[model samples]
Structure formats: C-alpha cells, structure tokens
Target: MKELNSIPIENIYYMLCYSWDKLDYISRNKIGIEESMDIQNLLCRILVDEVDILIKKGIKKNYKELNESSSVVKGKINFKESIKYKSTKQCKVNHSYDELNENIIINIVIKTTLINLIKIEDLSISNRNKVKRLIKYFNFIDTILLNKKIFKNISFNKMNREYKFIINICELIFDNLLINKNDNSAEFYNFIEDERKMAYLFESFIRNFYKKELKGAKVYREDIYWELTGEFVEFLPKMQTDISLEYNDKKYLIDAKYYKKSLVENYGSKKLISGNLYQIFSYLKNNESKSKKDEFSTGILLYPRVDKTLDLEYSMDKHNINIYTVNLNSKWNEISKRLISLIK
Candidate 1:
C-alpha cells in the first residue's frame, strides 16, 4: 500500500534507456513529476506531459491498409475482398482504404489508465489536468480502440518501431495495474523490484553513457577472445566486459557492477567483490596482454556508490586495476563527469 509517488521515474528511465536502442532521443526528453504521485497519474504525466517530444522522436504515422465500405474509390482496392456483398447485396462497394496508420490501440492502452485514474473518487484535484491532457492526446489519434481484446491483439513491430519506448512504458503501467487489480485504493506499482532488470539497466546505461560522452575513445560491450584456438574453446565460458574503451594505445576494460552492497567482507576485512575483479582481470589478460610485457591495459571495476566508497588501485602483472564508485544518486551532470573522468 505504498504511495505511487514513491516510484522513482529514474528507475523507469533507466529501464527504458537500457532496452531502447535510441538513447539520443530519450536523453534529450525530460519530464517533471511530484514525488508523491501514484503510478497511474505518473503514467498519465508521461504520456500527456512528454507527448510533444515522444511524437517528434517517435510515433510516426505509416500508410496502412484500411478495409472499408466506401462511397468513393480509394487506394488500391481488392476485387474479391469485400465481405459486405457476400452477406447482403448493398450498393456500397467494399474496398481497401489506405490511410495514415492510426496508433489508436496504443493510444487507448495509454488513455484507459488515465480514465481509470480519473474515475477514482478520492483522486486529487492536482492530477485532474494530467488525466485531461492524456485524454486529449488520445483524441489526437484517428481512432481510439477501447476494447481490451484489441489492445491485446495489437503488437509493436519494425513498422512502428518509433513508439517502442512509449509503448514499453504503457505496457509496464497496464501490467502493474493488472497484477494489483484487487487493490481498490490504487496503491503502489512494483515496477522496480526486478533486480536482474536493474543490473542490465545499470550496465547498459554505463556502456551508452561512455559511448555518448567519451568522444576520444571507442567503447564496446563485447566478448574478449581468450588465446584459445580449438573448437573446444567455444565451450569455455564467454568473457564479456561491460565496457572496453580504447583510445590509441591506452586500453581500459571496465565492468559495471550493480549490487545492494558494493563491498563484501573478505577475510574479516571489507574489499571489492573478488569475482568482479577476477572477471575484469581475465578480460585484460586474455585480450590486452598479447604476449608482450610492454603492452598493458587498465582494468576497472566501477560500481554505483551505495553506503560505502571503494576507490582502490593496484599495479600487478604490468596492468593497472582500479576499483571505483560513481555516485548515481547525484545530479546526472555530475554522474556523467565522473564516468568521463575514469579514463582521464
């Protein structure tokens, strides 16, 4: 029964930024929300509040085939595709109408929740405008398919790829509502409880942030081949670093770790997670060494700052290994600067 306002929009943004391929569009668009707003109202705000940016970046209309019984001939028509004539002879001709595809189903999926929010008798006056604006956006579409069956049948494909992020957010809002349907008070939405999802988001955000900001370096999130040649080497576990930055001769292998506790007790003393360090070291050894002592790389295990700080550095085996933390809770500008400063 926690309040919806407690749900952090940052988590949602992180999830979107992680799954969505278009980071430039998402990074540029921002929306403001009150901390105490419920998920339904927050969703409404996302739709109505950011509609302009969402429309500009995504939500492009496509020419779609529309079946209709028309008075006048329209776009390419099928001679045998008329269902009305088989049932009953009517003067009206059945033909295919080519119209700019209406994303009504998506619009309905978004607005339905807004309507539900408005129906709540105890809803606050402050959120009324949000609901109204969401409804207005729905009206902007060609049609509003209100049936849940239609919404279920509709799917996003390459044709409607632009709306991917917006649709994703809408799906989250509806899925949460369905799970908590028994609660009449319209309590909290548990969208952030997925730890695996958060880990992916954190990893992806770090990778993309570096790619966007680190102009001098080429960043990649890929597997590093161990010096194994035989086919059996494929069976060996794949070693993929969260990020690998290469700027001329300097190489930095970075692994982003998302853990509730950034540090662990090792031998009765606090230390960086050994497995993370081992993984990064493995990547550095397998890929960067290349059988030459003069050729070396820096391995960094970067973690989001939690309750403790871990800024440790060690030089061993002709490589520099660093354990650092970035305070994600700080302003995003500061976070970006911290990430960019890693290579410097």
Candidate 2:
C-alpha cells in the first residue's frame, strides 16, 4: 500500500468507508471530512460529526437490568436482599428491573473513543474541542475499559445499525492509537509502517468496493478446493480468495496485495512477486478443476500502486493471469475508474 500519509486524506476516508460498506451513508453526511486534514484529525472529525447526528437523532437505548431499592415492586423483587438491607422495614423493595437506557456498549465505545482521541497530541485544537463538545452529549452513557475484545460483544440490529459506522471508527482508533502510560500522552500509530493492518484494510476495501460497484456481478470471497484428494487432506491449508466476481458466466478471482514494494528487484531486473503469482495461479487452476467450466477462469494479482504502475499479463495452462496496480494516490474518480478497468 502507498504510505498512509502520502495518500490524500479524503482517499483514506473513502477507503475506510468502503471497507466498512458505509460509503453511501458517509457520502450523504460529508460535512467534516476534508482532504487537507491528517488521518487522526480526519477520523476524529468523522466521529464527532456522526456522534453529533446520533445524539440529535436520539441515542439508541436498550433494556438493561438494574438492581435498585425502590418502594414500588417493578420487576422481580429480591426478598432476601430487601430483608438483609432492612429495606423491608423501610417499605422499600430491592428489585431488579429492565430499564431502557442509553448506557449500552455501542454508546460506551463512542464515548471512550472520543475521550481517547482528546489525548492524542496530533489532534487539532478545533477537532479536540469538537470531540469534547460531542462527548458532553454522551454524559448519560457510561464509559468502559476500552479494548479490542469489546467490539466483539456488540451486535447490530436495525435499530442500532447506524452505530456500526461510528463503532468501526472507534475500533480503528483503539487499534492504532498508542497511549503513553507515564505521561498520559497519546500518539496515532503510523499506519504505513504496519503492513499487516494495511494489508487487511486494503483487501477489505477492494472487496467491498467491487461488491458495491460491479453491476449485476456476484462479488464475494470464495473457497477453492484442492484438486488432489488424500486421506489427510484436512491438514492442507484452505484456499480462500480475497475477492471473487462472477459476471455473465465469467469468473474473476482477485488477490489484493498490499506491500511496500509492488515488484521484487532481482539482480538488475524487476519481477512480479513469485509467491503472489503462485498463489493466485493455484486458486484459478484448482477452482477450474473442480467446476470444469468451458470458459477459462481469470486470476488477477491486484496491488496498490507503489513507486510505479504495473499491468503485466500472462497466459498459463489456458488460464489468464493479470498483475495490475491501482494508484491510490490519484484522484478518487480516477482511482475508481482504474479499479473498474482492471477486469476489463
């Protein structure tokens, strides 16, 4: 992938929204997103804007069980607790009741993410103030120990579906922000330095982008079975595609690769990464073997444009293989067009 800083902030925002499959929703509310802002500030702006809208629309409420001492018997009354606390004599009952409240996990994550964003030194004064203002609206929501595992516990239904976008941003903030224990200072981790995370983001962005943009095409990740059969075949690594598209009986299996260098330099000549080529080749051949389709399958090794653009084509064993690069640093429209043009 191109250096995160080098890529336009707007492009980064678009990539993130695409990865989360929230491009349309975000595009409709693009008030705070700007091309000039850095990634940290950009994310903070998005959170602040979205949270403000959420507060106005009324934060999502869920039924939470609360244990309280009350004169009225609401839910199930804890008779033993009432007697132990001497609330029986006071004419009060210890009862556990479910109350509709905004103190849910999704709101808590937003609040916690906002609090952490404030601690980052790179946050602009304007954005920091916006974050603080947005946090005030979340006063009714309780903050929790922010961790990656917290995201796993959250489930989205129709009522709370809007929170998915904001929570995704929160997860990104949680994953990338580095907080100093000594001074309580925080810094955003340079995303370009983390190849693993960038790879995931790049792959997800490409898959989702195609899923949304490809007309009448079935876009999904497909599992390719090995052609060879063995007694211990289970021990073999599963072959899963990054992005697979089927349009008009033509199959295209795309392997999205994000690396610092797109091509490997050997001796004096540059060559396509051998492992990537081999992997995509295996996916095409195995899938073709299983389906026995009359038309040959095409395999694409798609990479983010690094120092140069590459469009290499090859024909091997009746399978068409194309190694291409999409320039992420280009204009958004150009980037979209380039990606669409890949399969064509």
TM-score of each: 0.70, 0.93
Give residue 131's lDDT in candidate 2 (0 to 100): 88
What tens-digit string does per-residue lDDT give for candidate 1 at 75-159?
7666675655656766566777667764556655655656655655445676676567556755655434244465467677886
| C-alpha lDDT of residue 54 in model 1 | 54
Using lDDT as the measure, the top candidate is 2
Runs with alpha carbons beyond 4 Å of true place in candidate 2: 1-5, 32-35, 86-92, 292-295
TM value for model 2: 0.93
State the lDDT at 260 in candidate 1.
70
Model 2 scores worst on lDDT over the 10 consecutive residues at: 286-295
Give lDDT: candidate 1, residue 92: 60
> For model 1, what is the error of residue 31's alpha carbon versus the real structure, in angstroms, after optimal superposition?
4.7
Q: For each predicted model, how many residue pairs clash, with residues at least 3 apart or on different chains?
A: 2, 0
